[model samples]
Target: MSSVLAKVDWKSQGFRYFPLKLHYQRLFATRVQKISLDGGFTCPNVDGTVAIGGCTFCDNRAFSPSRRVRRDAIQAQIERGITGLRRRYKLEKFIAYFQPATNTYGPLDKLKTLWDTALEDPRIVGLVVGTRPDCVPDEVLDLLDEYAQKTYVSLELGIQTIHDASLHWMNRGHDHAVSMEAMQRVTDRGFEVSLHVMLGLPGETSEMMLQTADQVAKWNPAGVKLHNLYAVERTPLADQVRAGEVRLMELAEYIQILADFIERLPEQIVIERISGDAPPKNLVAPEWCLHKGSIIRSLTDELVRRDSYQGKNCRMQGLPREPS
Candidate 1:
């Protein structure tokens, strides 16, 4: 562990790492939930501009509830999401998250209209757009800047792994260099960037996964969402799992590796998510992922066992501390 952990009251907070909820409280002074919205966008990979099939492990419908339900007007979706989220959580302020597909892979006019419609609701305090690294051109970035100037805007880039061979195995279309270029470009624009990384790819070792984390720490993204590479029904990865060609990480193994991964990240990076799961009907393997609560609890326990917190082993020096 590093000296940084000495100043954090992680034990009292019930999480050894910096969680997104805490980050939100610091920024908004209240709990802010994310309302998932489908902007009716398709990926370059799915549309044949980049490649034929989407990422082998992806079935957007399985990952996003917005995609599973009927598509509605952007404003209507905001209303519906707000109503549902309000029913469950006490949060009033929400961030409009364009989550299902490549949100930036659209005409600028259409993108602006959708984003504008989402912000029309006063309760919506921020915007999150998820997309591939290759999809955001300079014009799209400029458009995002237009929004960032008005309100909080986070661009979630799907840099699943830093290993090019793993990307090739997943048919990710673009290589690691493309991700680095995208990161540099987004950072240049001064937009808050959150990276999405998958830990349990088909051939990656634990060391390889930690290497990805170490590299990401150097980039120093505003946030990171980590999840295991689980298989979903109707995807190529599912077929491989059924054929015994691929194996998924067990819960205990994933927790340990995730703890190690977080230790290598800068403490300032918000841990947006520690695990991900598909809807039970769409999930094909790794039944353990369905229990998100258990995954989080076990991971927290593992971190407690080590008496460590985020950045405990971080090599990056002189990074800004989390805002006071």
Candidate 2:
């Protein structure tokens, strides 16, 4: 290498390879807000259709703020949320994200009422329903499709991994087949789909993570959330971490794996989020990855340093055919 090139320090350069939030803001032409609504949705695992206690690594308490889970009418929750947000940010349009649990696991009208309540607020642009793949039904899909005609609607399906063994170990109620079927069904109805996939699951190698990204990109989803697995306090995985029964990847190692994952993903996929959101207070393991945007920043720096970019592996990848 040239002496001049060798002296160039990327650490000092400070540039991000893939900045996504800017793209979202540009599309909105303002601060596009996300108000997480509990909506009192319950998981299938806890509902006894699958298992109990939800995922072995899940603690909804860690994810929800106090205001989000208030036991009140859905409209009241939105009003209170908006009333609180009135001070800091003037967000004219927001996404009502049903974040706590499986949003589609209810009677058609019951679910419809919960969702329609969100639309009553003029500030609300649309709905962002978070649910397991298996929880979605035709009746729900029809509602989402019709809602999309009136406003923006994006379904965030938690298709964590394509590996069955990993799902089993994580106590995820549904399998990969369920995820595929859900995505196919959601897409066929012309509603936007954003998949939630995590990296570094138990027994899942980096190659397997890349395979999941390949499948997701091919599936023609509008958005994607790439999260890292962390052992949260009070979860079964935390016990394994304390006992040294489960291995946790270091931040740097995870960043390298995630860089590869990003390169394999399609550029068109709106990356909603890059890292897991386990606050230091609630996180029990993999403590090194808790420095907020450290993982995402490191991943971007690595990508730029390696001169890598997303969709670099698109042509060679044999992904399932979805609508163009």
Candidate 3:
């Protein structure tokens, strides 16, 4: 560890890792929340532009709350999300997250209309767009750049794993090279980028997962969201789990793996999400995933036991350090 890393106190921060909430507070000087919005977008993989049948593990409704309910206009969805979020959190500012599906997989004009409508609301402080790595073309990035000049903008790319075989097994439609190219373009435009990484994918070993973390550390993205692969209803993964073709990670094993993975990442990256879960009705396996609180608690305990914090092992692993 460097001198700075040694002098810091992790426990005082209430988390073993740098969390997204803290990152937002430092940037906006206020509490911020993300409101999920269904932009009525679909993926090229699903529409047969690139391939058929979306990712094996994907069922938009299971991952995005906005997709489960009745479809509404973009503005209406924002209003409804705000109303619901207000009841849960005492925050005023929010980011319009075009979540659900490939948010940037449409015509430039249509994309502009939806995004502009959300920003029209003063309460929406930023925009977080989720899409596949191959979906964001240069023109789409240019449009996002226009927004970045006006307000906060984050382009979330689903780089599930860097392994080509795992991607093929999941039918991700694109290779790891595509993901790398997308990250380069987005970061080159000075956009804040968040990478989504999935763990516990079938056939990935602990060494392979750590390798993905190492690559992510090298990318030095602004944020990262980590989650174990869990099966949900109406998805191919569920059927695989039923047929014993796939096995989900147990809670304890995942905690250890996740902690190890985080330690390999640089401390500057905001840990956007520690785990993912779905509605009870949609969730199919690893019943423990539904209990998010327990998962978090266990992760914290494991980190404490190891006397570790985020990036504690970075230097030992010869990972690149963030520029001072």
| CA lDDT scores, all candidates in order | 0.84, 0.73, 0.83
In candidate 2, position 110 carries an lDDT of 69
Off by over 4 Å in 1: 1-14, 60-72, 320-324
Residue-pair clash count for candidate 3: 0
TM-score of each: 0.91, 0.85, 0.90
What total of clashing residue pairs does each candidate reach?
Answer: 0, 0, 0
- Say which candidate scores most in TM-score: 1
Please give, for residues 123-227, the per-residue lDDT of candidate 1 as tens digits. 998999999999989999998987877788889999999999999999999999999998878874545789999999988999999999999999888899999
Poorest 10 consecutive residues by lDDT, candidate 3: 1-10
Best by lDDT: 1
List the candidates ranked by lDDT, beginning with the highest. 1, 3, 2
Q: Is candidate 1 or candidate 3 better by TM-score?
A: 1
lDDT of 1 at 80: 90
RMSD in order of candidates: 4.5, 7.8, 4.6
**Residue runs of model 3 more than 4 Å from their true location after superposition:** 1-12, 60-72, 315-324
List ranges where model 2 is wrong by over 4 Å: 1-23, 60-72, 83-90, 316-324
